[model samples]
Target: MSILRHWPSVRARVGRELGLVLALAVVAGGVLGFLALADLVVGGETVAFDTQVLMAFRQAGDAAVPLGAPWLPTVMRDITALGGTAVLSLIVLFTVVYLVLVRRPAAAAFVAGAVLSGAGLSQVLKAFFDRARPDLVPNAPIELSASFPSGHSMLAAVTYLTLGVLLARIETDRRVRVFFPFVAVVLTVLVGVSRVYIGVHWPTDVLGGWLIGAAWAMACWGVVLWLQRGRPALAADG
Candidate 1:
């Protein structure tokens, strides 16, 4: 029997809930991707709200100059560096070590799968959209990929938020469990913004990344819960 169908009603209900969330994410990602594709076909340009996001990205880039707030730019740079290779390596190394140390090999596999999937999806979307990065800023970070949704933002959301969901199982305080992931989410959002501020990404790009990441993360969490359903006494923190 397919696990979803084999599940008892309670587990089935949980699966359905997860299915719903994942469905929504798929719909949202599809819609956003379609809209972006359409925009590109029709001479890609931001609509009003999207334009605002781009403007915000631009202003953020300008403000990051570090004249008055010397450290502000540096801080933003660190966050913005999420797209850089060094940061990516750090994330990879940390995840590998953590999972190995904790003996949660499955957790590591799921996380690696989910993060890599999301990252690949983001790149495919970029190529499909084939949108161009803005020329408004000076010394734009060397990006040659299509700029529809920010890859950094998308990957960040997928990777960090997935970790957050997994972490939720380990911390049962209700408050801590729910809140910490939210903090990760907030930081992910900031990381997206930092990219925009650096003038390396269009605002819409980051927004797309956020939407995609959120949707994918929800879907992964649903799968994990489904797998863990029968064994309520599973490793989750209460």
Candidate 2:
């Protein structure tokens, strides 16, 4: 009877442990992947892959025209805008305000801190790499910044995934927990792909951005979990 009565607690503890382990593993893998890509990119080894991928989206003999339905370019532009600075900033602002209004100050701080730190890290990485935007095709948005690690892709992953994890942690429903993170992943992927499709960022640039951003988000979550381990329940729930 006691065993059965305590089963839910045991299960929850195990789940938390497993989640921590997975987050750490992702951090390790993401760092390694980013470093490997950086080495190749610095050595100019990714030029062929980058050029091929960039050109694949362009119409034959015309770099300006993307190969697809007439409206596809417009769609891509809109999708890319979802990860733009203005949109992401507004999203973070609103989310933080919502969290605060609900009296979840810790959660609000966590979200704001994670996003701001991720943005700073993205800029640092970009400045270090000093990579130029792809010129194989005319850029749709006409971006003018260092482009090794795409700011849009990184910021999207950081913001959406962080929010997803927060939502998942507070929710009790299995399906809802799964749904939030899944949508976050989808949105992150779409933003990254849009950057590449619109010729604003190299494929590797997006890849690097995703790797580092995910690692950062996971690391931040892991720290929060560690900090909240002593409490009876998730701080997020409070």
Candidate 3:
């Protein structure tokens, strides 16, 4: 009887501890991301690191010959397309429609808002930095936009992670809940890597994209959690 009585208290304590840990993690991530962006903007050591990594992928004297198989460039181009505007937009549209059909209009709206806002923020930051593209690589993609942060990397992180969290929320199985976000992160990382492989972005660009995108996704998740907290009974009923 005493053990049973104490079990509830123990569980509650554990839950509170977990919540605290998660909150701390989110704050730490956001702070680190902002620091990185500030360093990049101020032309700190990060710039040198970015240049070194960007150059390492190319041949010593010839930026055109990326250090990979002859066909790797083609493969990277294909992989990069997965994070392009067209593909991500289609993904967001389909997800919103699916959520609406399933009668979760709020969740659908959250998804749309998170992705669209993230895309807009990316453009604004790019223009604000107005950094030039890497001219070291002759075969790099011809991008006219500023290149401080890669659009593909940031948008991919935002869209995929937002969808991942949404999918995880609907899963009843614990394993499935974990799996959804894991796959989402994997896809995001792959997309970012493809940008560097193709020489369209500096390493720091992708890093900045991932950091800001993740921070944005986490913020949206907090909103979802807050909104849902008030409707626990309704959530349980569904």
Candidate 4:
């Protein structure tokens, strides 16, 4: 009798929360993809694609000279800087402050926690993998960190995507919600591509970064959905 009584409410809840299911599915795919890529990286199996992509960005006979106009590298450096630690940190700080000012302490806390933990995760993975940077070309802006899983690419995805989802949740308009996440995806893709073009990271390194970062963001999204499951209005402040 109790089971029969609960079935309708359970079905209703499931119907209303389908987005949560999708988010979880994405999280699963990202994790599995990242792990598979990592395996290939560790087994020395990514050389072909990585080499091909990196070499394609440079001139045929001169690896030091990138294929684009001389000014393009300068623009790429500026774009890549958007994903750097300093820039991302500042963005996170400003966002948290804005949320707090709007009396959204819970949202602020979640953003801070998610970004910090994601950054830590990136560091740990880089150290564990201990992969070397690409030497086929001279790195435009030299890097000192271990190379597999580009930090800039990962952090950009984490911070930008999380911020985008938060903005989407706060807005009630369907178009506005879609727009926020779309911009986030564009920024993330550009940052990852810049990492590859600059010669500081292997193609697989950026790929692994993107996969893990996306997984982390989607996991955060699932948490937000769970929090707002019954009360849609709570999306604005919490």
Candidate 5:
């Protein structure tokens, strides 16, 4: 066809890549949807595995807390802070301020949108599941909305991943720059695990959190990639 003849190769390749990314997002979302549905199906509005795991994790945390070294609690607290609202809030504020004060509005907006989108999705998932907290922890100091997919785990993946993406976009070194996402992935996982270690969430909750969060991060980064390709304003050299 005439249209095919005129189409640019680069554009065509990009279109194919975008289609693949979109397919991946759909599959990921479907998996989460299925998991949620299965949860409702298995126990009729109850999460069995998630509850059991959370209880087990909480018990483990309780037993370890007293027997563990003095510094462990402090370390867990620091890691747990990764999922705390304060940390995520500060990250957004700092990034926005840095971008605005330096007059890089486009980059700021793109990154902000990317991060907020992930946060919004996390809340939606939390509300959908509405799982309970661990009773074994005995003293759950801070409050939580849902138990299955931790808010902290989700945020850690979202915010930290967004930070990694932004950093990678600006970096010159290929290998070291790649570490941004790798480290963010590691930190996100550690924070999620710490939630269970500290007895606030279950192991299954963290796993679900990791799956959903990691998938969301991937989805968001996929969007960033598409945006970079689609719009000149949001495009970065990397």
Candidate 6:
């Protein structure tokens, strides 16, 4: 009788704990995959695959001419701007300010720290790889930085996804929670695809950026979860 009475509560707790474990496992897997990709890229093992993919977006015979409609390049350029420094900075600033206004200084600080650290990490990775930009396309976006991993793609993932996760956590409605992360993912994907479409980054560069950026975001989220779990009393008080 006693076991039966407590079984439901025990099962519920087990289910919740299991879910956390699975989420942690997924984050770990992502980090490992990113590290593997970094190794392969550094070893120059993905050059042929990268070239083939990048060239696919170009004219069949002339690598200089991009494929698709006449206005595609213009559209892609606009999309890529979403991941650029100016726009991302504005978005981050607005998000931080909003969080502060809502009396969530800890959350705001976390967002700022995650994004700034990701940006610095991107730069360090680029310097380490020291890969040159592709010259296959004539009208490629002008860039003067090392280009193994696309910084725009990586930073966009970090900033947008981090913000999404944070916003999702505070939402009481399930639909709104789902919507925030969905929008963040769509933005991240669009930005990465635009980098490739505009011929600024090799396909593998974008892939690497996505991998590392996702890993970094997941890692940060894991840290946040840990902090929250360690402060159940404080959370309850708040």
Highest TM-score, which number? Answer: 2
lDDT of 6 by residue, 1-238 (tens): 9989999767645644553565578567766876888788888898898889988988899977778889988888899999999999999999889777877778888889999999999999899989999888886768999886899989999999888877776776989989998999999999999888778898888888887887788777767665555353111232
202 Cα displacement, candidate 6 (Å): 1.0
Best by lDDT: 2
Model 2 Cα lDDT, one tens digit per residue, 26-50: 8999999999999999999999999
- Any runs in candidate 2 off by more than 4 Å, and if so which? 235-237
Worst 10 residues of 1 by lDDT: 229-238
lDDT string for model 5 (1-238, tens) is 8768767756645754764486477548846764874375336444565456555543354543422577876788898997888988888889978887777787777667866876787788778778777666655555658775777887787788777867865776889788998998899989997887777876666766676666766676666556555454232422
Query: What lDDT is obtained when candidate 4 is compared to the true structure?
Result: 0.88
Per-residue lDDT of model 4, residues 2-35, tens digit only: 9899997776468448868988998999999999
Question: Candidates' lDDT values, in order?
Answer: 0.70, 0.89, 0.79, 0.88, 0.69, 0.82
Please, what are the lDDT tens digits per residue for candidate 3 over residues 15-109? 44554457447747965976667575657657687778988888898878888889988888888887899999999999889878877777788
Selected candidate, larger lDDT, 3 vs 5: 3
Name the TM-score of candidate 5.
Answer: 0.75
Error of 5 at 25 (Å): 6.5
TM-score each candidate: 0.76, 0.95, 0.86, 0.90, 0.75, 0.87
lDDT of 2 at 85: 89
Candidate 4 residue runs with Cα over 4 Å from true position: 1-16, 231-234
Rank candidates, TM-score, best first.
Answer: 2, 4, 6, 3, 1, 5
For model 5, state the Cα shift of residue 12 in Å. 14
RMSD of each: 5.7, 1.4, 3.3, 4.0, 5.2, 3.4
Task: State each candidate's clash count.
Answer: 2, 0, 0, 0, 1, 0
Which run of 10 residues does model 5 get worst, by summed lDDT? Answer: 229-238
Better of 3 and 4 by TM-score: 4
